[model samples]
Target chain A: MNVEFINPFLTSLLNVMSTMASMELEPGKPALKTDPIAKGDVSGLIGMVGPQTKGSLSITFERELILTTMQKMLGEEHEEIDDEVTDLVGEITNMVTGGAKNILSDKGYEFEMATPMVVTGKDHTISHKAKGKKIIMPFSSEFGTAFIEICFEH
Target chain B: MNVEFINPFLTSLLNVMSTMASMELEPGKPALKTDPIAKGDVSGLIGMVGPQTKGSLSITFERELILTTMQKMLGEEHEEIDDEVTDLVGEITNMVTGGAKNILSDKGYEFEMATPMVVTGKDHTISHKAKGKKIIMPFSSEFGTAFIEICFEH
Candidate 1:
């Protein structure tokens, strides 16, 4: 995958978190994902396809981190992973992906993004048959750690 | 969703099963799905997005049905759901979606499809926040029952 295709997602994620939740995040080293399971209790996935690329974006969040982030994001308290929490996860995924799409479209990569799909379970894995290089970007915020996984075939 | 947009999928699914697995199938009346859980142990999801439509297609098969379908499709006997089974599910999803995309494209609905995403577990649910009408088309075959869910926003 081209690093140029990944920069937008990183920028969008950091921008979304800081703007929406008022949480500053520091990104760790991006690495290849060897494991199958998404390293979180909940994940939001958005699929992307263009003339030259096909990929999917997954943002997995630890349970406590999402709960805390959502509470702060919504200006309310969420005691558990209710419908609101799930919706928040989906919205966050959409916003980040849509933000990336805007930048990518301007760069002449015309693509369409599917609606965000939220999957919740322990040890659940999302396997995409894109045969792309899978990169995992881990970010840390005050609430906790989360990961942005991008698998792109160019 | 417009029936024009959905007919291609139904036709492709029936055609894929018959041509790929040599299995004849009967589709039940499509019904709107209000529940969150995809009603199967394994599911193949393909997301679709275009100028006029944004949604997903999920084909959930009973474990036995998939195992048997794989056995018939590949001329092999499989007792359990291994990586091959998972791979077959993704391929089937891809083929069906690709077939449909071809027809839809000919009809002027040019869209890009994401690579198939396979979700496997005992009791797992895939929640999409598209707010579209989710219609599940159930089919009964000699092996068992499966469903093709199309959630499209036009």
Candidate 2:
């Protein structure tokens, strides 16, 4: 596994989130949360593949956190989160991937990205076909908490 | 605008296509010869947003090209392109964004990427919304041709 592939992306994401959104993410011991946050929850995901391995990365957040994040991003208060808010989250994933891509290019990795798809509703789980490894990096902010999961197989 | 944000991604995609398969891409030009090939058409897309801009990246290819590429990646020739082939294309986009993200991180741009959606069809057009700038880089291969379109407002 190319651990170098993951480090730059993780660092870039931390810098973007902290500096641009004024949000703080403390890296916790690797673990997946046990409790469900309820259904109709929206989460952002990005997937990656290279000459050696392939996998997906996802950032899951609670509904309230997403709403508040949007509020801050748009610079206005909101009483309710709608389709526009969903679109906002999808775009957020795009920016994170964009930031990570830049770092990966310097390391000599080349690939293309797909348009984002917004998943809604509850009772859904994301499954990866990779049989090699999966790493989950959990994080939290003043607005809310989220997790980044990286799964890949060579 | 940030042409840097878009150029490397296009280049990386060209590299992936050329390296993974025997497809020859004529950069900056559309396909000169149309070949009738049997394969599914798959498209993957991701969106991006920030304090300064918002946009999306879309990559589309013929089904045969996707299957041949995956066969080359895995070093096995598959009789058909199934879920695995689609997943491979999605992962390719994931890799592309991962590379792009690193570059944008240095520029102080923060972003997140959404889950990839695979749309299958014979012939279709994918569109995005951007009020400011739009760029399209088209490449051709023996199996087929695909293009990357970046549209955003800064």
Candidate 3:
């Protein structure tokens, strides 16, 4: 798997959310976090294909983190999570992928993305094809914890 | 203008419909024809980026075409076009782009896409911008007239 293929997407996602929500995100190391019930958990998954093989990008966040982020986006406090909130999260992932795709296009890598699917709940495991490497970048914000996962086969 | 990019997308769309609807689409040159008002005119647009400059792909159709397509998809005659019909057309565009992206990615072109936005009207003009090269593929089916436009800069 090309780490280069994954980095731009993660960076763009962070930049978009940070700008949209006006929330500060603390950057940390890229490593997979396996805890199912982590604080604010919202996950977005999108598949990609190109030179190498097919794979997916999954971004997960604790519930609280997403609520605060959504609050900032909608300018309203949300106590209960519903379709609107989930849709917003899915749209965010779609935008991030779009931004990343634009940048990668300049690098001579043309990648198309699938419509994003959003999943919310604890103890839900996302499985990717058992090839290549898994890279996870975890972030801590005033709102909550979030991570981006890239699974691909080189 | 790369006809290579355009041909695959159009073919994939026909292929998907053929497999799903069991209807054989006669291969013909891209041209213009008078379209009837079946259900209503529905259009969706989403932007793309990569080796080329900024551009968008749009899919439009009449209400009748949508109803017929949806009927094939759902295996039933729908009395009227509703939310499900609208979503099905939007999803068709998404799937077509997803397939095209796979080919582009393999060639090392990188870009992102915006969420699909649905629009309704009659005789709407769809535009594309690519290095000052603009091409519009107008289509007329049993339902109505629709087209896809690609514009980008090299």
Candidate 4:
């Protein structure tokens, strides 16, 4: 994937976490996705297509970390994956992706984004039809670890 | 949901099942989706975006039926949810949605489709960010029952 396409999403994720939950996230090494099972118990996925690129972006969070983030963002306690928790994750995904879209748009990478979809389970796999290597970026915070994946075909 | 947009999918589904697996499917009534838990153990989802429409189409199947269909489609005995089985479902989804797209395109609805995504689990939920009613079309075959869900924003 192009660095020009990757940076907007990375920047947006860091900004979203800092602004929404007041947490600082440290991004680790980026790698290609070879595992079939998703790294987290919950994931928010959005598909994007542009005049020059097409692919998907996913934010996956471990159960405990997501719950902790939710507790802080909602200013309440959440012990379970209720509707509110799921919605919060979805909203976060939308905001982060939205921020990325804005940045990419200014760079002349005109793209249309699909609605974010939330998939919940312990052992579930996501496979997109696009033929390309997917890039997975690992992030860690005080709450727990999460992954941001970007795959685009240009 | 407009009949103009729904019939093509139904027709394409029946055609795919009959042609690919030699199974005849009878579609039931279409209803609005309210339950968050997906109806089947395995599901094939494709997102569709057009000049005037934006939404998704999904075909979810019971495990047993998917297994049986794989057995017949591949002319072999398979008893597990292996990668091949998942790939078969993804292909079926792509074919069915491709058929529908062709019909819709002929009728002047130009749309771009994303690669199909498959989710497998005993009990799972799929939530889309698009704010609109989702139409669920239930179907029954000799093997088992399945669902075709369509949700779009005009």
lDDT of each: 0.82, 0.59, 0.61, 0.79
TM-score of each: 0.88, 0.48, 0.48, 0.90
Candidate 1 regions exceeding 4 Å error are A106-108, A140-144, B76-80, B142-144
* lDDT for predicted candidate 1 compared with the true structure: 0.82
State the lDDT of candidate 1 residue by residue for B31-117, as single tens digits. Answer: 777766565767787777787778788888888899899988999888876668888998999999999999999989977788777
Query: lDDT per residue, candidate 2, A46-86, as tens digits?
Result: 55545554555656666677777776667656555455765
Chain A TM-scores for all candidates read 0.93, 0.80, 0.87, 0.93
Interface RMSD of structure candidate 1 (Å): 1.3
Ranking by DockQ: 1, 4, 2, 3
Candidate No. with top lDDT: 1
Name the better of 2 and 4 by DockQ. 4
In terms of lDDT, the poorest run of 10 residues in model 1 chain A is A121-130
Q: In what order do the candidates fall by TM-score, top score first?
A: 4, 1, 3, 2
Clashing pairs in 4: none
Candidate 2 residue lDDT tens string, B1-154: 5667776677778766666665556776422112212122666665565555655666777766777787778766665545666677668776776567766777777555544544454553443434445566666667666766666656
Model 4, range B1-154, lDDT digits (tens) per residue?
Answer: 5888888998999999889888888989888787565557777776666778777777888888889899878887778777778778879888998999999999998777766667776666676656677777878977888888777777
Q: Candidate 1 lDDT, tens digit per residue, A1-154?
A: 7888889999999999889988788999998776555567778887887788777888988888899888779887887777788889999999999999999899988678888777776655666666887888889877778889888777
- Per-residue CA lDDT of candidate 4, range A17-38, in tens? 8888888899998877765555
Best by TM-score: 4
What would the per-residue lDDT of candidate 3 be over residues B34-132, giving only the tens digit for each residue? 221122366555556454544556666667766777877777687654445656765777776777777777776656554443444444333332234
Badly placed stretches (over 4 Å) of model 3 are A32-40, B1-154
Docking class of 2: incorrect
